[model samples]
Target: MATLLVLGFSSGLPFYLTSKTLQAWMTTAKVDLATIGFFSLVTLPYSLKFVWAPLMDRYTPPFLGRRRGWVLITQVLLLLVIAAMSLHDPRTGLKMLAVNAIAIAFFSASQDISLDAYRTDVLETREMGAGAAVFVMGYRIAMITTGALAFFLADRTSWNNVYLLIALLMIIGIAATFVAAEPVLNDAPPKSLAEAVVLPFADFFQRAGVLRALVVLLFIVAYKYSDSLAGSMTTPFLLQAGFSQSEVGAVFLGVGVIATIAGVVVAGAAIGKIGINRSLWIFVVFQGLSNLTYYGLSLSGKNHGFMVSAVITENFGLGLVTGAMTAYLMSMCNKRFTATQFALLSSLMAASRDILVAPAGKIIEGVGWPGFFLITVAMAIPPLILLPFIAPWSSDVPIGAAPHTGETIPARRPQPPLAVRR
Candidate 1:
């Protein structure tokens, strides 16, 4: 569990460096909002990471076994690149900054791929709920560090120093890679590139069938669309609304971190008692309705109380929905293809933020903040409507259940000799 927590932090830390926090820095630096919005493209690697997940699965690096080896390499590269970010000014070196930010994102996404596979490999079915909750808590905590702490620091120090400190924090992940044991897979690693690339999809389609798989895929893509759309401009919105950096750091990011952790813990318990499908319905509603807080904040006009309330509501809902969704994704993977399968699901899940929300600034310019947030509320509804078809209230599917056979499907490939972790 400690390993998962550290790994999750490692996976999440670099995210905002290239994203929300970066946008905040740009906003503070007086960069145009449209350019900041376009900067969201740097994170496209996250949405496209499934493209290389096959490679991660097909071959083991020479050190630290397959998963940890990749984790170590990515964390080290992320540290180096993030530290290098200290040298570039967003004002004078916007293009160079973009390149380094993309490198951080690339390594960050790769780390996430390895960490997700490691979690899926190690945790038992019944343990997934708690594991997801723990991971989300860790991820959110990292967000607070990079989002809130970085904002607070950037207000006082140079963005360079802020980024350099964040780079130092990557040591937590690197140390974890050294101490953590390599997870034993039930099935062997893929033998050929063809097997790595093809079998995971084949296994998924065989287990779920064409129509059901499509429904699941659609839900994955749409479930978090509303929050993501609203979130794309949240920092800019707060800045425009007359909140000081300290106010946003304390209220929006700080309060948000606490509320989200609470939500994740509560949602984890709820998933155990009520099951994932019903949890999805409940949490998605929480997430969807929470968007109204932003609209309300817009009307309330710089009220700190409303800002605090808004951040707490929206972040808590995000935490609950995210925790439930993480467990749902883990439940879908077959052990042999855990890395590739989860990458595909999570990549699709990220498409809303990484692709669909990239144009959010243009939308906000057209509709105004309240109107833009209203559109996000509408975007959140379709996924809840999808739950009946993809993850119904009454269905009792187990992990790795085959649709046609109605039997548990074990890992297809045979186990090879265990790899040692350094």
Candidate 2:
């Protein structure tokens, strides 16, 4: 659990550095809204990481076994690339900054593939809910460091200095990598690159069938769409609304962190009692409705009270939804193909954040903040409609179900080993 937390933090740090923190830097550099929106494209690697996930699965590095080896490699690259970013100024070197951001995203996405596979491999079936919560807590804490702490530091020091400090923090992840135990899987690693790539998809489709698999993928995409759309422009929105970087950081560090942690804790506890599907239904409604706080902030202007309320509500909801979603995704993976399958599922989730929300700048310009937030709220509805089909409210266990649950029955019978099938 401790290892998972540290790994989660490592996974989250580069993420905000490239997206949210970079947006903050660009906003302060006086970049226009449209460019900032389009800049999200740099994170395209995150949305397409599944393309190379098989490579990680097919071959193990010489040290630290399969998962940890990749984790260490990606962390080292992230450290160097993020430090490289510190040398470039967003105002004068916008294009160069974009390139650095993409590199960071690529390494970050790769690290996530390894980390997710590691976590999936290590945990017992019963541990999934608590593990997701702990991982998310670590993930959100790292976001606070990059999001809130970075904002505060940037207000005092140079953005370059802020980036450098964040780069140095990668050492923590590297240290955790050394300490983590390599998971001993019952199944062997994929025998070939072809087996790694083709079999994960084949296994998924075979398990869920074509129609249900399509619905599940759509649910993954839609579940977090509203939050992603709204979050894409939040930093710029807050700055444009007359809040200083420190003030924004203060709120995030204070109520935002507290509320988010609370949500994760509550959702984590609730999932065990009510089950993941019910937790998703309950948490997602709040996730969507939380956008209204931002709508209210847009109307109220720079009022700190509204700002505090907005931050608390939105982050709390984000925490709840993120916890539930993490467990759901983890539940869907087969042990042998965890790296590829989880990467594919999470990449689709990232699409909503990066690709689908890329039009947010144009949309915000046309609709205004209030109208734009309304659209985000509406975006949350499609997934709710999908729940009945993909995850029925009455069902507690996930589709494939994690192995070794004595009480819960898997929706489908376990298949023979890949070797046997081949």
Candidate 3:
């Protein structure tokens, strides 16, 4: 549990450092919004991580086992690349900074793949609910550290120093990697790179059937669509709403994050009591309702107290849905393809909003904040409509079950018969 916690921190730390937190740094340096907006392209690797997830599954670094080897390598590279980014000036060396930021995203995405696989390998089926919650708690904490604490530090020190400090935190993951035991997989690994890349999807389609699998994929894309869209411009929204940087750091980053962690904990308990399928329905509704909280903030004008209320509502909802979402995605995986399958599912989920978010500026321009938030709430509906087919409230799919298998397979992993690769 402790190992997973630290690994979760490592997985989340680089995310905002290269995206939102880095944007904050550039903004403080007086960089143009357009340039900072364009920098978001560097995070594309996250939406494409499934493309390379097979490599982690197919090979190991000879030091740690399959998952930990990739985890260690990615963490060390992340540490170096992130620290190196501190050497460049965002204004004078914008191009160079872009390149380094992309590198950080690459290693960060890779680290997430390994960590997802590692968690799947290490945790028992019954433990997945609590494990997902704990991992998300650590992840949210890292976001606060990188997002809030880093912002606070940058206010007092150089942005360069801020990056360096953030980079140093990677050592905690590295230390955890060294201390953590490698997962024991008794099944034979993929016979070749080709097999590793092809079989996960093949197995999934075979088990779930083409139409069922497509529905599942669609549900994954729709589940968090609004939340991601709303989140993509949260900082910009706060700034434009007349909130100061410190106000955002305190309410959204500090107090909001705490509320989010609390929500995850509560949701974890709820999952155990209600079962994951039912939790998905309940939590997603909360996520949709939370969008209204932002609308309220928009209507109220620029009050810090209202901002805090909105932050708590939105983030707590995010935490609730995300905890259930993580477990749901894990349950979709066939354990044999934990890295690849999870990557594909998560990447698709992320891509749904990423594509929509590109046009967010235009949408916000047309409708303004209140209208934009209403659109977000509307965007969440398709997924709720989908839950009946893909994850019906009465369904009994065990937490972390292998694809179509209703029964949990422990220790020795088994692959359901593969479908023909089309």
Candidate with maximal TM-score: 3
Q: On residues 127-219, what C-alpha lDDT tens digit does candidate 2 reach at each position?
A: 666778888888888988898789889989989999999999999999998888777666787899999999998888887788989989999
Off by over 4 Å in 1: 19-41, 86-99, 151-162, 230-249, 292-304, 357-381, 395-422
Query: Tens digit of lDDT per residue, candidate 1, span 89-122?
Result: 8788999999998998888888888889877766
Please give the distance, in angstroms, between residue 54's alpha carbon in candidate 1 and its true position after superposition.
0.7
lDDT of each: 0.83, 0.86, 0.84
In angstroms, how far off is 12's CA in candidate 2? 2.3
Per-candidate alpha-carbon RMSD to the true structure? 6.0, 7.2, 7.1
1 versus 3: better TM-score goes to: 3
Arrange candidates, best TM-score first: 3, 1, 2
Question: Cα lDDT for residue 410, model 1?
Answer: 27
Residue-wise lDDT of candidate 3 within 30-125, one digit each (tens)?
999999889989988888899999988888788777777899999999999999988999879999999999999999999999999887777655
Candidate 3 residue-pair clash tally? 0
Worst 10 residues of 1 by lDDT: 402-411
Off by over 4 Å in 3: 24-37, 89-95, 155-157, 232-249, 295-304, 357-375, 398-422
